[model samples]
Target: MGIKAFLSEPLARYIVAQQHEWIAASREVQEKWRTGLVQKAMNTQFGKDHFFKDIHSYVDFKSAVPVSDYEDLKGYISKIKEGEENILWPGKPLYFAKTSGTTSGTKYIPISKDSISNHINSARNAILTYIAETGKAQFLDNKLIFLSGSPVLTETGGVLTGRLSGISNHHVPAYLRANQLPSYETNCIEDWETKLDKIIDETIDQPMSLISGIPPWVQMYFDRIIARTGKKIKDVFPEFSLFIYGGVNFEPYRAKLFESIGKPIDSIELYPASEGFFAYQDSQDEEGLLLLLDTGIFYEFIPTENFFDENPKRLSIGEVEIGKNYAMIINNNAGLWGYSLGDTIRFVSTNPYRVLVTGRIKHFISAFGEHVIGEEIEKALRYGMERHPEVEVVEFTVAPMVAPEQGGLPYHEWLVEFATLPNNMEQFVQDVDRRLTELNVYYDDLIKGSILRQLVLKPLRKNSFIDYMRASGKLGGQNKVPRLSNDRKIADELTKINQ
Candidate 1:
């Protein structure tokens, strides 16, 4: 791959031009955005009931619309699916993104034309922003691969339902599709194994520069490419430079990816889901994603400590303090008003704000007083992995062992599937357990007080999580192993395979 200077310069300039006023005066921009969005949709059903016209300020908006979730807005969503008009948005959505449901069953999120435009723009801006920051347009010369779901859209109840990545695939311009690897036919393959095999067959010899997808699946793609070619990823794609990942933290996969690629390249993180494109890593100097304040979505933060409260205090962007975990709430052009996305984030910066995704609200283990999250588990795993450089954890998940049936004392149970197993299991156990003790005070106290035993480690059988997801019909595209669970559901399921 060589210079694609002409290709990126115009778009890069356009992005910067659009961002200029917003980046300079984010607070002012945000205030204006809220007003415009509220006023424009004031006649919609939700707006009428919530008194959107009366919401002249953030305080008024907060007072009018309470923090909500899928259940709170399901009535409006149901009407939308039935082709109703002026329910949440002004009219029916162009599509319904069937979420890879958490603990709850399937959720159908509306994707209106306006909302989808916003999603596309935000994602576009992220890549352009990086191009502007790094001044490396050569990477754009080659194909940009999105190891996403199929491009085929499925219609249901007068609205389409599909994975977000697949939905995105449908929107790729015909011109760009020439540069986008993995042809339409390969991407549409229903079974992940077959699809992955096809992707390898199609893109292995192609000039790939940028790769974007959720971390685990992308890793799987890389593994296959490497195994078949018998070469490092860097050699496989000589110009490969950027790997854009979202839906999960990249820290856990960092070491293994580096090992596979044989060298480091620029890695960008995105926070995109069916609901919205929330944030992207604006600067690789700092690891956190810069909050996309001027995107179509208006954000609110509920302190994680009070996240389960019937009425948790919600804080505006300005009101959010640094280093505090908050469950994210949003009011967006999509008609998701005061809706919590069920993800938690911790702020790292306020000026030109940036934040780290800490965990999922539904995916955590707090069997006793010790509340452990994905962030802690990642940190613990990173610590262990760093110590044991020879070993590589391909994937892992944790669940609470809360009863005497499993063991005498209740403790966290980790199921790790190794790419390269640790030479010593005892060393692996000590490394992860020691890190968790250092990272979480409550966990340390529980272990010290004998209220909880040291965390247990279990090696998962090969392809265990993959097999599980496949059986559950969630094998690919944004479906991931829940890093931590409140109960032993995932633990029991995986344990059966090992047995």
Candidate 2:
């Protein structure tokens, strides 16, 4: 390695220390962020036309700024609908990072040139930290296989509008950039089917030293790789060292991925989003550390229990409490001020801000890592128990079961009390398996030949989820059923009911 490359680890440590000092000393950053929020509230169309005369008069101006969902950005969509720059950033952004919103199927979030530079700097810091922790700077020479988003750009009036992965591919370090495989341009559309096939074909013969992507997509890619190559992943990419993943929890897919790759837990978790690149695994051995990008964005942490509570206190990096889960709020340069990234994490240490991700406060299934969401499991059960063509799902609750006799592994037992029972119960169970397999390849692998057997579909009375919700005292408002459960008592009770 060159002297510059060799010094990267020490430099990274120095930068991290400097950031901690900045957070400690800078009261101006916090004041400036709050001032920016006041300015946004004053200028906001919602606040001016509806709420109050001026931003200062608005009651709880921070709270008054309506929490925006995907639908809220529909006006801006028209500009990018024609692949043109519209709102939020100065000048045309480099490209959009295609992300799946809760309601919007696929939306392109802008990635400005400044944002790209921040991402690069954050990524480099993460690498350097890893090297510093492991004393493995020589490993940097190994090839990295990014199971990244496709590089294809949509042509609207001869203009390119797509994800930043492609744009970044053209801009990474020359030494590292030289090792990448060809892009999946032809299969780069939003359709998962086409993209999956292309990923499989491309990765089959390539020598991959490190891999990175979301866990579900990575599992799907490997499944296709195995199917197309007719060889196990170990037989192909035996040299694979690191598995870098983010966007979702890795626990659900962890066992299956290890089985397929026949690799150890040599993995790294990153906490990045379309909005910004935030934290990454500082050490190869430690869980993850939230290295505040002090120059890139201002940070805030709201305790998870205070998400919807009347008076929520926002904690800055310096004031954040350790061992308590907090939702991330960011003041990003791309015009997002005090924006919630919808991720929940807890501080592991305060000095360096090491943290562990504890799932999305809104995106958990009873705080467990089983890949089931409310809509997904409900639809699966309803479709599974189809006695008559009109058979529909009225309610359902997915409970976890650990059966030693049944392959000695934990499984999701669907207490699916349907509106109508299916004529053939076996067929219903099989249909549930098929649907789940189609949705998540990891679940499919477990059901097929791994430790777990098929998912148990138990018919319950209608209003199961509702009854459960009511019993939990989360009857109406915005409360929903827990999709996954880790509480042993709940899991055991549900498992007993299934049995």
lDDT for each residue of candidate 1 in 184-209, tens digit (9 for 90 to 100): 88888888899999888888888888
Q: Count the backbone clashes (under 3 Å) in each candidate.
A: 0, 3
* Top candidate (TM-score): 1
**What shift in Å separates residue 213 of candidate 1 from its native position after superposition?**
1.3
In model 1, the runs with Cα more than 4 Å from the true position are 1-4
Give the whole-model CA lDDT for all candidates, comma-separated.
Answer: 0.85, 0.59
Model 1 residue 60 CA deviation in Å? 2.1
Candidate 2 per-residue lDDT over residues 96-138, each given as its tens digit: 6665555577766656665677677777666666666666554
Clashing pairs in 1: none
Question: What lDDT is reached at residue 482 by model 2?
Answer: 42
